[model samples]
Target: MMATPAQPDNGNADVRAVERQQVDSPFFVQTLSRELSASPRRIAVAIVLAFTLVRLVWAYALGFGIDESYTIGQSRFLALSYFDHPPLHYWIAHAASVLFGTGWAIRIPTVLMFSATSWSIFCLTERLFGGVAAVFSVLFLNLSLFFLVSAGAWIVPDGPLMFFLACGAQVMVRIIFPSPGEKEPTIIWWILAGGLFGLAGLAKYSALFTLAGLVFFVIATRHRRQLLTAGPYVACFVGLIAIMPVLIWNVQHDWASLRFQTGRGSPQFAPSAFARMVLGQIVWLGPWIAIPLVQSALHAFRKGRTERELFCVALAVPAIGYTTLQALWSGAGFPHWPMPGWLFVFPLLGARLSGRIRPAIHYAITISLLTLTLLVTAVALGGSGALHRLNVPALHDPTEDLIDWSPVAKVLTPLRVGRPDGPAVAGLDWAEAGKLDFAVGEIAPVLVLGRDKRGFATRSDPRLAGRRGLVIVASEEAWAKKGSGLSCLPEDPLPVARVPVGRAGQAELTLLVIPVEGCIGAAQ
Candidate 1:
């Protein structure tokens, strides 16, 4: 016989069973101190608070942006190859989804990865500088605008990439100049690092840039002697091997991804693009601290013969130089592309400034840090309306460095889900196209045709015309390069849907959905 709901605990058949987890699992209550620091106890409480609150703000307030859906979609596929980027972030995010569950889980791996990196930075800085600089440095990293906004909530190659890159940086510095009383870095340690690089490379092939950075940066400095060591060479080669699956995948696909990325770099490497990229980096670095960081970077190289200083400077120089070259060579680079460069430089800056930047540098750093935090709070809380209302030109103007996919995804998702029979080729927006490729892959595979890229369309070419299911995922500016019909649209959206996305009630996205789902099997 079944017991009623009013039965006592031991005798009640209706009592719900509760399982034990961590001491502070969601089921348990946590203290204020427990929710604000690095421990699992603090993290569990704080993560739920931050992630849920931020996600709600973004979910309702943010319209789907160009790359959002597609990045999510790519993570869904979890491959080592893609039309753009290697497959590391995608697969990890996918794996995280499987581990924790998707939607929010897509972001969990990145969150943990970034946090660990920050913690490692804290430890490294603590060792290099004093505890004060270390704490502030990690604090600055976690609270910084780019950290919270672009790189934080936004799941991309750079987040996981940054984590591993930062880890490598920690290991790298130790290998170059062992700190006083520091243990000798062993071969097993190098192997562990080699594995991290392999995993990091899967995030973005540009990790090769880091590999190149290490070789050149070391040669440029006192660690130049260590270059003769077999460990160093083995470490480098092993990293390449670790990520070799992606290379193999690329070769099988005729290196289409590499050509697509490298070929695109030329226009961005032009004079103007390079200048914009530099300016963007300065902004992300925070203007007040940016100058000093630059000073520290320059000083470490120019004013130093010491092994410690040389080792620190060595890591910073090459990756930044390579990134600059790529931007000048192409008209665009991912905004977060400079991340590993930042990771390398930060501790270098700390090491240089340890006894120096403190107290004196504290004022500028504090002002800069506070200003950034205020700006972030305003932006995060939907208070950017004040800037817009005041007609701050910066509030309304769009810089071309980054693309928005929020509105476009909003337009595509419901319409496609509602209809379940439409997909098409896009004329403009690889970010949007890539995002769309990711978002729609699970529900149905959409064939995004090449309207740009000078004719890169093996994925959806004429070889499969008679097959069913297809769609066009183009933006107006992109279509202008080729489609006269799309180019000539006189306002009102050229036969499509447009959705806008933004915070503070402003529209920021534009997804144009045209029915063509019949070409899916064809593309497949």
Candidate 2:
């Protein structure tokens, strides 16, 4: 008020104004900064909503995939376990199917599971580092091609596995790195963590790697006292109890499930499998994520180790190592095996990006955002047939597996609609049977021939024992080579129709009307 020499024209305020101008100079950067500055909760919600919208669009646009068809068939009958995976996905699908209906309804649980996984990542990251890291973690995870577009969006076990793993990771973080002035949490956190780990096990056997990671962390950090505590034992008990259904099912069936799962891994190493694993990691996880994972491991080993350092290393190494071992041993295309491994690394990645590696993180975000836009565009165009004009080879056709089965349903409905009580529609294997069933929507009771005991094999219809049915056979090269011209009635069959079902409706499959001469061979 005393005329204060006109405030002395402080140069600091002028410099600050210049700095603000520089910060907001670029329109794109300004927009991103504004977004990042939003409340972490709001940012998380927006990310989840955006990711969910993309998934829902794809779900609505595309028809059921082969695996989805199989899932629906399995969900139709509640079981303690399944031939291919545990029962959680089927259970969720069963509930969704009962509540909403099939088709998109079966996928609703995946969407919700993925949302939960994303939110869990945000929470875990925020707790470990801060809000900015949480946002970055969510973005990196939700934008991954494998995580977002494939397993994360599909109605599969991986969806639930990732959700529970993320929940368990948060609890594990608290156990390993409690904040300052904090007492160790009651056994509740460990109990909850174990329960989540158990649920993850119920989702997929790969969850063993998660538990292994926990052990590795304890051993590496010399935190053997954790073993003496009730937390570890409780976790073990809870996880075992969670997967009790699988164990019970195996016991009743004479350990068939355990035998089958264990038999999958053989000790034959293939260099090509390792190469594929490496390449796939780059493509699906994106270089942004892949690099950070390697960096996190390196930092843990090369620098002073802390609970944080050791935790990140353990979470990623065991899962990735197990996946690599599988791939090298079996030479199977197990690209998504390392998904959970990549998951816990996200927070560490986010922390690194927000700290000294801010420049690299900025570039990664830009690339990932652009890549996501392109992916959405491609998926949309795929539905509209715009991408088909590119004449991509069938082998490389990403949408080949998603071929519209409505045409097949149309042709078979006429043949089966008149014979609902008899063996109506049949397939040479469970996959085709499930596909036909999903497409026809109960126009006929679809049956599978041969010993391919998948989901459809478990369903025995006494009516199908000797009844004649129309068999829909996929036009594989092998089938064509042995062609005696498709037939019906096993003794002297007749070809009812050979309908071509695909993008252009060209006959790629032959529907044979065959009578079940004997008990169609049992599922192998």
Give the per-residue lDDT of model 2 (tens digit) for 206-240.
89887888887787566777888888898889888
Give stretches of model 2 more than 4 Å off.
1-41, 181-183, 265-267, 356-361, 385-395, 406-421, 440-447, 460-463, 467-472, 476-478, 481-493, 503-516, 519-524
What is candidate 1's lDDT per residue for 89-145, written digit by digit as tens? 767767766887545445655665666777777666666655545644665555445
Best by lDDT: 2
What value does the lDDT take at residue 165 in candidate 1? Answer: 72
Among all windows of 10 consecutive residues in model 1, the one with the lowest summed lDDT is 15-24
The parts of candidate 1 lying over 4 Å away from their true place are: 1-64, 99-105, 179-183, 217-229, 265-269, 325-335, 356-365, 368-429, 434-440, 453-465, 469-513, 516-524
**In angstroms, how far off is 180's CA in candidate 1?**
4.9
Candidate models: Cα lDDT each: 0.57, 0.71
lDDT of 1: 0.57
- Alpha-carbon TM-score of each model against the true structure: 0.71, 0.84
Candidate 2 — what's its lDDT? 0.71
